[model samples]
Each structure stands twice: as C-alpha cells, then as structure tokens.
Target chain A: MIETKDLRFRYSDTLPFVLEGLNVTIKRGSFVAILGHNGSGKSTFAKHLNAILLPSGGKVLVDGMDTVDEDRLYDIRQHVGMVFQNPDNQIVATLVEEDVAFGPENLGVPQKEIRVRVDEALRAVGMYDFRDRATYQLSGGQKQRVAIAGIIAMRPRCVVLDEPTAMLDPVGRREVMRAIHDMNRTLGITVVLITHHMNEAVDADRVLVIDHGKLLLDGTPREVFSQAETLYRADLAVPQPVELIYALRRDGVDIPGDVLTVDECAEALYHLLKSRTNTRG
Target chain B: MLKDISLGQYIPGTSVIHRMDPRLKIVLTLAYIVVLFMAKGPLSYGLVLLTLGLIIVLSRIGVRFVLRSVRPLLFIILFTAVLNMFHVDGDVLWSWWILKITRQGIETAIYMALRIAMLISGTFVLLNYTTSPIMLTDGIEQLLGPLKRIHVPVHELAMMMTIALRFIPTLIEETDKIMSAQKARGADFETGNVIRRAKALIPMLVPLFVSAFRRADELAVAMECRCYRGSEGRTRLRTLKLQGLDYVAIAIAAVLAAGIITLGVVLP
Candidate 1:
C-alpha cells in the first residue's frame, strides 16, 4: 500500500507550493487512475511516489517506508517504479533487450537472472522479438513498451505511469494502454496511471480526480463519472457516451447518468427503447 | 575547413569492407597510412592508387563519394604541389627567376598530391561507406580497453562518445525547430553584417542551448533511474568478433602495404 499525508511541494524556496495539503491513500492490489488538468499536480504526485521528489511538508510512505528518509529512499524507489510521459526520456540503452536489463543490472542481479527477467519483461509487453533491435528505430509505442519493460524488470510492486500514452498515436495508445491494463490485472501489480483520457480511466479499480492540487473526487469509476457537472466545472471532459447519456437523462429522458462505457451505454439504451415500445403497445 | 567536414555520413550496405571488424578497419587504416607516407617514386604510388581503386570497386562505394571527400582539400593540394615544384633542387626541366620545375620536383609534387588524395579517399570510403558511428566507437572502446589498467577513464570516454552520437540527430532537429520558430517571428539568419549576423544568432542559440541542457538533464535522470552507475560490470550485447573475413581483409591490407613498401625501397 502507498499513502500520502498532507503532502506539499514547492518548486523553489520563493515559489508557491505546487502541491498543497494533498492527501491520498492507495490500497494494495488496486489499479488506480489519476485524472487531472495541466498543472493539477498529478505528475508531481507521481514523482513523490518514487522519491524522485521529496515533500517539503508532510510525508509519502511506500509499503510503510517513508520517502523522506535518506536510507530508505532507494528501498522506497525499488517498490514504486515510474514510467515518464516521454518514452525518449526514460530509455537508456541502445538495444531493446539491454534497455530492459538496465534496472536489474543496476540492482546487481546475476547475469543469468538479468537475462531471464529482461526476456520475461519484454515478452510480457509483447516486444520480446525486438530484443536485438535498435531502440531508436522502434516506433513511439514500441519505445514506451520498452520503457515499461524496463520498469517491470525492476519488479516493483507499484508502477506509476505518468501519461505514457500521451505522445502516441491511436494505435500506439492502444498498445501501451493494453500493456498497462495487463500489468494491473494479470500481474496483480498496483498501477497508478495518470492520464487526461477519460476513456482510459473506466477500467481502473478506483478513479482519482485532482484539480488545482486538491482532491476533487475519490471513488470508483461509477461514483466519479456520476458527478458530471463537477467534472465540467473542473474543466475536465467526461467520456463521450457518459456525457451524452448524462445530458440525455438531464433533459428528462429516462436514461441513466452512470453509463461510463460504450457497451454499457448501448445495453442501457436498448432496454430503454424496448420499454418505450412496450408502453406504446 | 571545419565547416566542410562531411562527418560520419556513412552509407548503409553489405560489402566486404563493411563486413570486416571496425577494430581491424582502424588498424588497417593506420598501416595503410604508414605505408603511403613511406612510399617513394611512381611504382609505389601506382600500387597505392590501384589498391584504393580496387577496394572502392569491391565495396561498391561510388567514385562520387571519393571525389566529394577530396573536394575540400583541392586548395591545400594545389599549394603543396606548387611548394614542392619550386622547392625541390633536382634535375630542372623548366626554369624562371627563382622558380624552377625540376624533374624530381614535378614528380614529387604529383606523387605527394596523389598520395594525400588517395589516402584520404581510402580512409573515408571505409569510414563513410561501411561502419556506423556506434559500432566504430564500440570498436574503438574495445581496442582502447587496455588503457583502463592505467586508470585512463576509457569507459567514460566511450560513454561520452555514445552520448554524443545519441544526441547529434536530436541537436540537429532541435536547431532546425528553433530556426523555424525564429523565422516565424521574422528573424532572418541570412541578412546581416558580421555583428548583426552574430547578434541575429542569439535568438536561435539561446533556445538551442536551453533545449540542449534540458535534454541533457533529462538524459542524466533517465540514465540514473535505470541504475547506470558507471561502466563497472557492464556488458555488451553485440560482442566484437574478429571473423574469418576480417582476417582475410587484414591479410589483403598487409600484402598491399608490403608491396608498396617494397616498391618504395627498390625503385630508382
């Protein structure tokens, strides 16, 4: 489990705090998605999880280990691996397999074990075939997958992906999103995905809405998307089908505001239309 | 002179030279240079030119690439040829006041110019038409690995070369973007005096530096996050292998060098 207590951070001594009085607790084995606008402190929070940035006030604890403690910083980081927004920024090695082995090698894993973990990580991300390939020659999605595999090789309990799909095209986005979901469901690894795409958030075990450095909503996907007006006021766009269903219900149609997915929306609409036909008959 | 540098513009292809180990290629380059500089008279010069011509043909690298490599050195060749022509005090074929073109002078000037051109062209054709910068640097690091015993920071040098190679395309792309951004703001790089032109570069330079530093910092953090402490215990995926072809290539170079050296010694 990861927990933060009254976490506050300022970019510098003279600057205003970027994160203010923020408090969040993530449960073990839960896939949580963080949604926020630009400068909403989502990325800043991700950094704190890995001890990449220490809090100026309050504390962050990873698996009950405090990030502020210098001795435990590396230990904390090893538990909470992070994948950044830009795929280009995170990959270190020139070849695909070598890049994956980077983290394990740093931790001084044995050569044989490193090779095993590297191959496993690559295979997990469906990029094992690219082991001998030059990393620079890969596409954005492939590169991001390599970055993800790099983190996975660390075998961290929680993987914090900060908009890993942002720079990718539609196809690339699906590839990364699929891999992130796989890590969450199959591996049972705790995943904290910070993204602006609402559609990407629906499958999360929990959704966190952070606006202007304050927790706006904390609930399951159904509870969060139910509050459509709040999301609009926060300058966040809800998933299209959810928004349409919400607006339709608000206009006195008998649909529900809680249809967070296209398939669910379709099912709900089919039932509503059938009832209307029955009422006419 | 620096601006004219063609730098690492190697073409991609499968050829005998390209297939050889870069370590051997570097060694052969050195050996070839030693032989060429020691070479004297027409016979040795003909052999050197002929060997280079054959390699160029076998490698399938075009004559245009060799010409391009030699183009920038035209002025230097002409100056050296002129100097050798007037300076050599041997059997005169033509004369003027303080200017004499002796048989030895004329021959020496032609041979020197041809040697320099052919030598440069040969090395470049190998470097540019075959080996990649990454492989070249890796080969160099492997070759220089012995220096680590003397505490010479060989790994660091190799790392620096790798990073520099990694950033060249990125920096070029960044500079292009900055130039375009400034152009959008009506900044002209072409229209100004020496001072104005230097000043005009300020906008482009500042952003390029900022972006470069940002990229460097990002790279450092990324590298560190992966636990890259240094070269200690690090291993390579593509280990340097001196293949059968590599040995054959070396033998060929040696034969050429021996032939050239013999011609240089035996010629009148």
Candidate 2:
C-alpha cells in the first residue's frame, strides 16, 4: 500500500515543479495504471513511492513509514520495488538467477533463503528455464521479465514500473504485462504501472491520469476511457476500441463509448444490429 | 562476428574439478605454476605432468579444448624450444657455423618445451576452460579478501570487475547496432586508411558514449532502489562454502608442489 499526500518535487529551485500537490493512494493487492504523456510526472511520482527521490513538499508513506525518514529508507524500498525503463541498464549480474537474487542479497537475506526466492521469482515470471542463461543472451521481452523477477525476489509489498514496456516489442509488452498481472493476482503484490499505452491500462483495476504534474482524472478503465475529451486535452488518447466507439457515437450511430476492448466493441455492434433487425421485422 | 564471441570459456559440467571451490582452484593453479618451474629432472617433470594430466582428465573439458588454450603460446613454446636446443652448451650432438646442437641442449629443449606446454595447460585446466569469468572474479575477490584490512577495497573492485564483464556483451551488441545504422547512412567504416577508419568511428563513438552514460545513471538509480547500500553487509546468493572435495583437492595440490620441489633436489 502506498499513499502520497500533497507531493511536490523539483530538481532545483531554478526549475519549475515536476510534480505539484499530487495526492493519491494505491491500495494493497490492487493493480493501478498511471497514465500520462511524457514528462507529466508519472515517473516522478513513481520514484516518490520507493523514496528514490524524497518529496520537496509533502508526504509519501509506504504502508505506514514515511519516505522522508532516513532510517526507514531501506524498509520503504524493501516494501516497494521499482523497475525502470531500460532492461539492459537495470540488470547488474551476468547470470539471470544472480540478477534476480541481487535485491534479496542486498537485503542481507541468508544464502539458502535467497536461493529459494530467486527460483520462485524466476518461475513466477516464466523465466525459470533461463535461470542459468546469461542476461545478454535473452531477448528484449525475456530481459524485462528477468528485471521483473529481480524486483519480485525482494518480496516487495508493491511494485512501481516506470514505462517498462515502452521500449519493448508487442510480444515483449504482452509478456511483461502478463508477468505483472500474475504477480498481482497470485502474490497479491500491489502494482503501479506507469505507462502511456492506453491499451496497457485497459486491464488494470484502476487508472490515474496525470497532466502537467496535476492529477487530471482517476477512475476504472471504463470511467477513464469514457472521458475521451479530457484525455485528448491532456495530450493522451483513449484505447483504440474506446476511440472507435466514441467516433461512431459522434457520427450519429448509437453505441457504447465506454468500450475498452475490441471484443466488447464488436459485441456491442452485434446487439445494435440484432435489435434493429427485430424492430424492422 | 563480434556477437559470436563468448565472454567466458566455461564448459558447463558436473565434474569434481568443476565443482571445486574457485578460490582453491585459483590458489592451486598458482601453486601448480610454481611446481612446474621448480621441477628439474625427468622424475620431477614426470610427477608434474602426471598431476596436471590427472586434473585435465577430471575436469572433463577434453584434451583438445585444453590444447586449444595452448594455441596462443605456440610461438613462445617453439621459440623456447629452438633457443634451448642450440644455445645451451654441453656434449656436441652436431655442430654448424655458430649453431651447435648438444646432447644436453637436446634434453633441455624437450624439458623446456614440456614445461611450457604443461604450464599453459595447467592454467587451462584450472581456469579458462573450466571456470566462468564471474566465478574466477569471485575466487580472486575471496583470495584477496584479507587485502581489505589493508585498505584495498577488494569487494568494490570485484564488483566493478563483474559489472564490467556483465556489460561487455550488451555494449558489443549496441556497438553492432550503431555500426549497422551508420553504415546504412553512408558512413563508410571500411575501405579507408587506418586513420580514416578510426575517424569514421567518431560518429558511433559519440552516441555510444552518451547512451552508455545515460544507462549508467539509470542503473545506479535502479541499484539504489533495490536497497544496495554497498558491499559492507551484502550477503551472496552463491556463497563459496568449501566442500569436502575442495579439501581433498587442496591437499593433493600441496603434496604435488612439495613433491616437485623435493624431487628437483633428489633426482639427477
């Protein structure tokens, strides 16, 4: 569980605030998708969750510990792990299993326990077979999964991934999302996925949109994507299906504008046509 | 072609030699080098050869693989053999203008040649052909652990070594991508003089350096977020605990070294 209240941050006094007066709470065991255009403070907000960058203004609490407390830094990090954008950058160890075990080793976990956690984490990400393989030998998707496994090995209560799939191919993106969703479903680990991909947010339990360091919108995928005008103003777009439905509605066709998936859009069309045929008969 | 280059020459196996502690393997390999040089007559060299041969067989890395590791030393081995065959003076086997091959010289040539081959093969058996680079670095770190008391920063050095080794392949791949991209843009790296080719690389080098720095910065942040305080209290997932076989291997190595020195004094 993570809670941020009136969070304000900036690189220096000369620069404008990157994140200003942001307030949000991420519940335990829930998947949250933070959607925003580039430089909208989604990533800056994610950093505050694990105390990577202390707030210049307000408070960030992980579970109950404040991020500003120097002594609780390690505890805060252990509770909330972060995966950055570049997979190649984050992997510190040559071997996959060793990289996964990196976090636990840093926490000073015993060797035997670390071994167990490494195996479990790798398996959870579907990368158990590549445990002995070199990190460089893996593809982009596999590398990102290994990064995820590295975070999960820390046994964090929550995970914040900063545009993790931005650099990945479509298949790699799916693999990483599957791994993240699996962690949330099975391990009950709270997940905050910071991404601009509207389709990626479709599967989340909730979505928070940020615009110019301000909280623009917050709701479920249906509620968020339905506000196409608001997202467009923020320089973001709705998922394709939602956009298509919204377009159809504007063209004088009666259809649901809140549809988030292709399947849902197709089913809605089928019902509309079937009802029309019945009325004509 | 660069992509095919393997970083470590580790041949994966479950052999007893493979399972030996890397620290012990490193010490024993150094000790074996000393023993090879101390060997004097046929008996001592024969003992040294036997020990090294046994290790080679136990490592299960194959004789050809070990022999391949000696390929780079061929010129040196030949030069030593050729020099020792004619330079050392004793009973004359043959004589030519400024080149006399003596019976003593012939014996010395064969001995020196064998010593060089055995010395090189001993390294292959204990190191390159068997141990992974990371494990070899780990071994070095543990062996140098005492140096930390003398303000050596051994752990940090080893961590740097491992990190460097880890990034080599990643960086190579990035280089290959950049080279291809530049080539597509009419950046001719080939068909140029030495300086011209070097100059052509400036474009690739600039972007590569910039990206590498950015990666390093992000990696540092990621490492910190994982609670990496330093090497002070960090535990290892694969701690090198000395097994029973390691003790046996160390004892055998000590005996072999002592036997070689004693035989050097005793044998004619």
Estimated TM-score per prediction?
0.85, 0.95
The digit string of per-residue lDDT tens for model 2 on B121-172 reads 8988788877888899999999999998999999889988989888888888
lDDT of 1 by residue, A131-211 (tens): 977676789999999999998998989999999999999999999999998888888889999999999999899999998
Estimate the overall C-alpha local distance difference test score of candidate 2: 0.91
Query: What lDDT score is found at residue A184 in candidate 1?
Result: 80
The backbone clash count of each candidate, in order, is 1, 0
Residue lDDT tens for model 1, B145-170:
89999998987898788777656655
**Highest lDDT: which candidate?**
2
| Model 2 agreement with the true structure over A47-88: per-residue lDDT tens digits | 899988999999998988999899999999999999988899
User: Scored by CA lDDT, what does every candidate get?
Assistant: 0.84, 0.91
Interface RMSD of 1: 2.7
DockQ values per model? 0.28, 0.80
